[model samples]
Target: MNPVLGQVPVYNAYGSVPALPLGWVENYTPTGQPYWFNTITNQSSWVYPMMTSKKIPGTNWLFVLTHDGYEFYYDRDSKTSVWEQPEELKEAMQELKKLEEEEKLKKEEEEKQKALEEEEEAKKALEEEEENKKRVLEEEKEQARQEVKRIKLDQAVDNAEDVEATEMTEEDIMWQLQQMAEEEVGMDREEEEEVQEEAQKEEEIKQVEKKPELSEQECIEKFYQLLKENNISPFAVYSVELPKLMLDPRFSLVPHNKQKNLFNKYCHELGEQIKKEKSQNTKKPENEFKELLESKVTTKMYWDDFRRKFKNDPRFKALSVTREKEALFKEHIRNNLNKKNPIEDYKNLLRHVKEIQKGIRWRDAKKLLEKYDVYHAIEDKDKREDLFRDYLDEL
Candidate 1:
């Protein structure tokens, strides 16, 4: 019979075999028989044939046959060869799964820890904010308590004075009554009439003294004096201070309806006075600060350098608030350093004055230029007038 088609072709030794194909390799069996193996398909056979296989759809797997005649699958992508499935691949897959689970657990634990830390930080910030609020509230409470105590003390003093006055009046009345009784016991008819008339006159005097009235203007002045004596600020709340003010006997002299209006008016006047005094006080320091800047600072100098240079100087230290000092420094730079020609600016402003004439006095010219900012650029009135004179001569 003819040889079966595709029968095995055997080789005796490795060197006896022809050069293997690109994807085929030569191997030896236990009997020293040469065999052909396909690396891509994971197939082995004694016969060498040009064989091809289709890849699994959407996969790198191919159906392969082992040398032992067992069916298996081969992955060209991962290069995994197995009969059924190798125990090592399964064990490797299990190990890979375990590693993924560990990584996931580790990430989750880290996320939980991060979330807990954020929560703790937020809780700490909230607690600190609450503590600050509590501290401020306690401070306000203490201040209010002190104010109430001071008011009570003032009221107590007023009450004591009134009580003493009342006792003195009662003692005086009793003494007068006893004198009248003694005079009546020893008097003739004419003397009795005199004593009776005198007693009537004394009663009228006591009634007048008990109900003495003050003029409205005097009452207002008295109340104002009381406010001054107590050192009450113009910013003092009317409702809050009313109880303290009422402790003064003069507070009752004014009619209730007019009292509020009077209090508002007095506060307004006091406010204006305080404002004027504060402005005056502020000017001294501002002037000193300006002089210090002019003497020690240069146009090239910045605020930090100037402050460092003269921080210990009395003129620099005169301005207490840092912002105020910074503001003045900025203003000085804007007015003096930034100006290319301040005198020329002043001249231009004077040129715009329609009321200025050739022979106008410096005072009249100053009044006209007072409305212009450039006119105030020069701090000294005399120097400004001198500059105006120079400008006039130029004209």
Candidate 2:
């Protein structure tokens, strides 16, 4: 009797494993047994012989071969190694072979089941995709059919008239069309001329009324009211304990942008300032300034009173250019001088002395500049004075 397998250590099967893994070894030895190999040092050392095996189909034995060494004997009848083999290995070997075969069969069945499931899923998915494609195509065909029907219906319209048999001459029809176009163009042109003429009249009226000078005290009061509405706080009293209020962010007279809103906030701030001043004045004995300032916004009497309040005051002192010969000579002097860079009171007295020396009346010089656009024409100071002096002398 010959035995191909032994009750050997598990390490004896490592030669059957293929190659190295990156960081792990293949651990395919049977459980609960260990094996050892002899090192390259001794000649009489016995080793678990390396063998390769395959089934000779429909036989009770498996064929065996050594791993390139010729020490082992081959037995063709039993299909096992004959040398250095034991009798106790037959049952263990048979059990191991049966377990391996059962595992392989189970794995093959699992793979076949997995493949069948995958194929079933793929078939169901394909069927669903085909159904969706059919539905989309059906909807597209239905929409195209409806569109074609609508076009045909429009072409074969209801309440349409039949063609007339009478022939139309091209020359007469063209003449009629030309006459109609001329009449329409003429009507449009006349309407356009009328609109333009009306617009021109309105523009002329606006142009004539465009005087930069302050027209009335009502306008002046409105200007002050507008400033107060924009929340422009006046300068405060130099106090110690009170929180200093900042000027409102809204009071640029000639602002870079947003003049309208700034004007509105300016009025609001000034109104608040007036209210504060009024509250302080309520404690004082009868004051006329607060009363006049608190007067009605619509009152013309307030303007007259305001005019009277400043009348004959030194603030309105007959300035350097005061000449009484012209009716608005005082106003003329006030108008021509830039309000921002006003002449000092002492400087006005000197200019008055110089004007008296020129022998041309001072009022006449102020009037000449105020009435006409003299600023554009006048370049030379000396020449202007000479011409102005001549005009005043003639006056």
Candidate 3:
């Protein structure tokens, strides 16, 4: 048996005369010029006594003479034959397998070619899409540029037309001025003639006295009207230019005393408004606290130090009330000492005293501490002596 090509050395059996190596009958002329032969037998090595066959007319049967000279009838209807040699079968199978493999390779190549074409088509489509996008963007940009250019051109043309229509040349301006001067001269001559006529008439009739000018109240109201028209604040009564302002003919009737009284009333009103604003501002706790902190009184300075620093300050001077000053002093002390017992509070204060005298001579620091009654804190004689020596060495 052959595993790859199935069974080899296969044999065929007909009916039972005796089994022989299979041989095929052939068509031939009487001179033995064979036309067709089909056999898988080893007939060249075996001595066959005879071999012959005759096709039965009108039927698919043959009378064959076997190698042993036995006459047998082969019925083609039975379909028994080993007509091909082993080598020929193998060769035919190999050709068929090669054809199948070639067909499979051809199909795979065709599929790969189709896929490549599709990929190329897709790439071309993508490139065309990008090109279209870029073209649209460029067209939009061109349109926008053309729109801006059109706007600028229109503006330039409009400006040019305006200049041409209304702008005056130097010669034209000079001619206009000359014409105005001539008209003024003619008017002056007419006025002179009228004055002469009026003078002649005055000699014929006595003139009545003119009524007195508008009174001070009316003058002041006119002055206020001018100020309102000019948007000047009414509270500007104390402006340095008040005398110049009074030079207007309307204000000429206003007595100086009345003006002084008016200015003083406005000044008082302004002061009252300022005081009201200040009081309102102080009513807010944040504003008051901010002012207190900015004074640097509570956090950075002892009461005595704060008083020493700000004694001349108007706000500090306003602390003249004894109760308020005492309360301030108590707040300062409480902030520094918290709620500690007297002994602890005094010790804390001594720490500040030590800092104040840090660079002074030890003897001087001791004298200062003793002046402040630091010794009263120590009842034990030895501890007091030790404190005295410590103070002396502090510098």
Model 2 vs. true fold: TM: 0.20
Per-residue C-alpha lDDT of model 1 across residues 105-146, encoded as one tens digit per residue: 999678556645654566587679968976796687567656
Ranking by lDDT: 1, 3, 2
Backbone clashes in model 3, listed as residue pairs: none
Arrange candidates, best TM-score first. 1, 3, 2
Q: How many clashes does each candidate structure show, in the order listed?
A: 0, 20, 0
TM-score of 3: 0.21
The models' CA-based lDDT, in order, is: 0.68, 0.45, 0.53
On residues 1-395, what C-alpha lDDT tens digit does candidate 3 reach at each position?
44677643232444444434246444566887654333543233323223566554445655565666654445566644432323434454455457768989999678556645654566587679968976796687567656755775677568556765677789977875686577567756765786688567655554432324677677667755544454444345434435345434444355644654565564566568778989877655334333453556543345566557766765555545645664555454444434334454344545667444544554565565553322333445566445545654664
Off by over 4 Å in 1: 1-191, 203-219, 222-253, 260-279, 282-286, 298-308, 317-395
For candidate 2, the lDDT comes to 0.45
lDDT of 3: 0.53
- TM-score: which candidate is best? 1
Off by over 4 Å in 2: 1-91, 118-122, 149-395
Top-lDDT structure, candidate number: 1
